[model samples]
Target: MNRRDVLAAGLLLPAILGADTGQERSTFRIGLTPVFLDDQVEFLKRWRQYLERRLEAPVQFVQRASYREVTELVLHGELDVAWLCGYPYALNADRLRLLAVPLVEGRPLYRSYILVWDEDLTSRSLTDLEGRIFAFSDPLSNSGHLFPQYVLSMLDLRPEEFFRRTFFTWSHRHVVEAVAVGLAQAGAVDGFVWEMLNRLHPEITRRTRVIERSPEFAFPPLVTSIHLAPDRYALLARVFLGMHADAQGRDLLTELGLSGFAKGDRSDYDEILFMAEELQRA
Candidate 1:
């Protein structure tokens, strides 16, 4: 069968099994971008458990070492749901639909942070970091790559010409550790990830300083393929949006460093789309 046919069949499996079976017949698949995986293995485990128990269905976690890989899986309907970076979601708006966005610092907004070593007082701003080695989380990441690139463009500087060298660490925690361990003179990271690291890995964060913070932008969001049945997507949405209200669910969110999940509209990501356009224009 083609992708659309497969997706239709997957969504109907539960009903096709009929109610007499007394067992859930469908597996709910969730894709995760690599950005949050390295430091969040335990959290992911707990999250999977919470989802499975809450939905009373088998839950599987699909992940890759690249954001683009996971994003493509969701876009092509290989995954029923995915937690994706705003950049990819905005780029694939037609193929993907937002489910919910995690609330950080009590808001559905986060920023890109430029970080340097704690003792690196020589760099007070983005301009001061010229000719220094830098790390980015992922090429398709909003906070880790796009936003930082946008900032440089705003300064009329291209990343290649502004930095001595740069690399992608694939995970935000790795970006924090790169700067903290002096592997990179500076790095761009997800502010939410930085905050989580500050609490979980103080040894790494204590040595890092925020050199710059991009203005508030849309948070990364959970999304699903537009091909999925509306009821299937709506069921997933109800679980997330109501997670903070249940005891077990609340614990899971706390472990994930999220306040809760809120229904997110596509328009919530317009700023990111605008930034992407600006980056291409410059």
Candidate 2:
């Protein structure tokens, strides 16, 4: 029930161990990909350590090399709980169930923005990005691709037709750097990631200006297998929602740049689903 209990259950380690531990030990593996690894690894490791103790299972935090690898990890039943981007969740909604959502500054919403390399520019809107060398975080990224592309499609434009070149930087920090370093004219990236990068690595974010803000959307999601037992899933949900109320748990939440965790449901992802369907029909 407490975070210290989670750590004792071994939930903080990697998912490299066999299924014997996961099944027999009453534990499951959870993780996000490498995008937040640099800033949030400590928090993830600590959360895993805490959950292992609580569930009395050997808990592990799986490290994914890329977004595609992360999706496969969930599809193959290797990851029990994944903090994932919206686009992947939208496509795999049939296989995953929403669990909890991280709140940034007390809101469970995040946004994406078109960022240019000038702070004083008054006309760097999304329309201005046309025919420009644009960078995205990844094909599967929610803020970096899906949502932004969705917006573009709404305006009767396609990425390939709208941009002279498009590149997937694979990380929000990289997107910031790409525009700042003049490698790309503009990019769409997670607002939270941009803020975190700016705070932790200002030299990169300072050079980029937010030219446009996309509609607010749900933040990264925490989900589990559709096959997971409902009772245990409910328990998992309760534990996460109550986490930030604890001492050490609060510290870990801060480490992850979260105000707290809140109970969420599939309904919160409906917008992403609509976007995916539109993209598919296009």
Candidate 3:
């Protein structure tokens, strides 16, 4: 199908493709959140079909509106695997096994971008926007929420006290939208999402400009519950790690703005964990 046709099909296919029919006991379920996937319905359908073909098992992509919901489902073993933010993964590490991390520009690292409207040339840093409205993607998001919060904490200021008002846009794209349209004076968003949107939807990104970029942190990762069978987990990991080697898989990765997947090290998230720990103490 052409891109337009695929996008249309994606909007209409969720009920038919993503719902649990209660018939496939062997289905390998993977969870997602708008933090990454956003509205790429066609991409999800294509990736699901690719995974089903590779694993020789039925594959299902379960999507939730927020990272907290996806993380809770994965922790309760309701989902076989999930693409999760580094903060949530660190918060529940003992119950999850790192499955794979996506490579962005060939590195498994990304940053948090603090943004302002393109016309707002005077605001160069977060302090410049103090007492102005702010947008946060999700409470559990590392780059969107934690990193921004950590910045405030380091300055000995609290979000409620620093900003006149703050709100959650629930997704990184919306955070950008909130800032671009003047709904918020500033927003914290995932750098990967911002870059991807700049590539695919520049009209929206052109209205906003990134003012600050945080230190590199491990990118969001795909994780499986520790309760999963060893063989099943290995199979899932192998399929992901081998994506770049296969033509069709490589195409899917490109469409998804990824370089492929790596059997990522758990230690990669230590910085996120340390930030979380420090926040708890504060």
lDDT for 183 in candidate 1 is 97
* Per-residue accuracy of model 3 over 110-174 as CA lDDT, tens digit each: 99999999999999998788889999999999998999999899989999999999999999999
The ten-residue window of minimal lDDT in model 1 covers 17-26
lDDT of 2 by residue, 80-162 (tens): 77888877887888888888988998999999878998753754688877778999998888889887788888898999999
TM match of model 3 to true structure: 0.91
Supply every candidate's count of residue pairs whose N, Cα or C atoms clash at under 3 angstroms.
0, 22, 0
Give the TM-score comparing model 2 with the true structure, all chains together: 0.85
How high is each candidate's TM-score?
Answer: 0.89, 0.85, 0.91
Give the winner by TM-score: 3
How would you encode candidate 1's per-residue C-alpha lDDT over 1-282 as one tens digit per residue?
A: 999999999778867876534333377889886554565777888888889887778789988888899998988888999999999999999989899999975799998999999999878887899899999999999999998888789889998999999999999989998999999999999998898888877988999999888899889999999998887888899899999998988887887788899988899899899999998887
Error of 2 at 5 (Å): 39
- Residue 276's lDDT in candidate 1: 94
